[model samples]
Target: MSSSVGPGDGSANRDAEFTETLKSVAGMANLTQSRQVIREIGSSVIQCAHDRTVSIIVARQVLDGLAGKLRSSGSDDTAEADAVVDIADYLLREINAQGQSSNLVDQTVGLCEVAATAFETKEEYTEAAQRLASIPLDESRRRVSPEDKVRVWIRIVRDYLEVDDSTAAEPYLNKAKGAIFDVNDAELNLHFKLSQARINDAKREFLAASASYHDISFSPKLAEEERLHTLTMAVRCAVLAPAGPSRARALGRLYKDERSVMLANDFSILEKMFLNRLLQPKEIKEFAETLQPHQLATTADGSTVLERAVIEHNLLGVSLVYNNIPIASLANLLGLSNDEAKTEAVAARMIEQGRLVGRIDQLKGMVWFEGGEASGQNGSGKTAAPVDKELRYWGANVQSLAEEVERVTAELQKQFPGFVEANLVV
Candidate 1:
């Protein structure tokens, strides 16, 4: 009679074979061959698990075989899990070990799914997030650009927001803002703008949302779809702003223009409806600054007047020795003839008097005056009496210029206190 080996002995032999095969493949320097061998071993283990005829001993052998494959270079967690799903309890211990390893993302993610299906727990979801975070963000210009950093940040913010963790979300949103400007691609910029608008809208900061929309609308590099969406947001914000005189005018202007109408119809409907009411005085100021002088003049009323040209001559000699029109541009604006405009003549006289001392290259075609105060002498030094007169005249002119500037600045402050604060005059 021959001594026959038991099922446990055969299972142990198979397990030893699987382990030896895995060790051989892992030790090989050729990655491709090792992967092929691992796959073959994994398939055989999975087949054994599916065979019910195999005893618990055989099942253990199969699991051990799958785990050995997992340790191999080409072995993945999903494959390992699939091969041993029948023995989840046994697999759980192995899964935890794999999850803790640096090279176990595929296995961890697979384990997460299995764990979620088999056992629902808060830790599972947390583990899933952690495993997902571990995957290095693929760096590619076409697919996952640097601009996607903002999108990732925004997604994180939304997740945090869902948990009512606004404090945590705020930093993510701020990071998104900083990332948006760093992107070079125009298409990405439009996406960033839209994301910002959505975030602002969710925060109920409609004005900021509207401004973001406006930026998208006027973006020179944005795609057509992005531009349309941006215009829509602008129109919507305009309507949502207060319906005062300024808002009404802005809405009327936006509606009358072809670009505005195109944007109004294509962008969000809610934005269009609220566009007129969202207009801020600061927005109006920004818009006004971009317009030409003629455009601004055309919109002026009885209280408005064209701004006077900046005269760069001494105030004393301005009326007498020099012409009323100081420069060619000023002369043209004032509707004076070339001869009547003594800009050049006055400049020449100043040069002779040493009041305007500079290189001929600097004074080739224009008058360049230096202040008498900058000449390094007081009134009593040279040409004593005339110097005193010059000093007194300059002092009065400076005082007068200061008063005028102060008055204009005060008026600007009343009209736009926020603007004045941001742009304090030196």
Candidate 2:
């Protein structure tokens, strides 16, 4: 009972015990273990392949285990494919050892998913598209489900849109359209329409494009905020459509309904110009004389404040005598500087406004007011002063001034008889 083992005996016994434990565990477990265990084993297998005979068997086990894990995960197919690619180089090395072409084919075709995973990482969409295209349709139909195909097409379309080559993208667009229409899902349909709208815009088919744009406006599948954007595109297309007169009319009606003061004034000015060009000189003169005296005043001061009025009236008279020479040239005759001439011209504009005249025109060098009234003043009974001596001295002769004013007044009355009574005189 007092027996004691030596150091060598104790070492031998420990070795025996360790060997037995290894044997039991090795027999109890399958060739491949859990995913975590398999991953570790796969790493070891890669390391062992550098120098050990068990490398091929270990790599095979790792691949089988990883494939099983991928199948069970049911979601993360891409990640699963990526895991397979991690082992591809080792697998290829072993397959090369076999010296069989069929072995190479079997290995490559078996890991199509892995190839896809690696190809996608290249970020060359054209290459990915080519690889995907090379996979037998039947094999893809069996291996990747319809839902996966839809996802793939979505990715392809996104990539194609980035490239922005309409010719190269047409087939992808067609494929996406088919996938969208074939699927009965409302969400997918809306996505399809959105893509179609983009493609249609690229193709320059605005009418067909608008239809797709309109679909997204009320699509329940799209977010409310996104639907607003879609609605905007539809409205834009409707406004820009070149084919339909109805659309043009509708836009015109909307604009007219929303008329602002600025827009209304522009229209009024334009209409008066059109009518002025259409009417004869006698009619134009009649229209000018019909204006109230105060309407023609340069300032709001009473009619007797004659200097500003004379300056204004004489400016008009100079325009008539000099064939409506610009105010800058008239300024030169009056010995005023450019800025002074511009100021004088602007003052003349104020007088025209007071008279409710639309515009001043120089016909054959003589200036005439297009929509001027006879009284030449506003409702306050103010009248412009007679032609100033200074103005007459500056190349504006009395005879020419009187004749021009008379002629313009006659034209105004001829065009509008009662217009002068209604708007011009007190």
* lDDT of all predictions: 0.44, 0.44
Over 1-426, each residue of candidate 1 has an lDDT whose tens digit, in order, gives: 211234554555665665566556446554333444544554554444344223434444444444443333223344433333333333444434334222332333343334333222232233333333333344232244557666556545554444444455566577667667777766665655666665664454545665677767777787788677666656655544332233334455556547764542322323332241222234434444542333233212221111111111222223223332335643443233453334443333334344333211122233333323223222212332132234435768999999999999999999999999999956
On the 0 to 100 scale, the lDDT of residue 410 in model 1 is: 94
lDDT of 2 by residue, 1-426 (tens): 211223344434433443343334334233223334444443444443333323343344444444334333333345544444444434544544544223224233344444444545544456545545443334422455555556556555655655554556567667766556456667656666677776765665545665667656777777866775665454434333321223333234323432212333323322333222222234334433433232233444432222332333334334334433554565554333454534345434444334323232222222233323323333211234322123424545767789898898788889997886677653
lDDT of 2 at 373: 39
Q: What C-alpha lDDT does candidate 2 achieve relative to the native structure?
A: 0.44
TM-scores for every predicted model: 0.31, 0.35
- In terms of TM-score, which candidate is strongest? 2
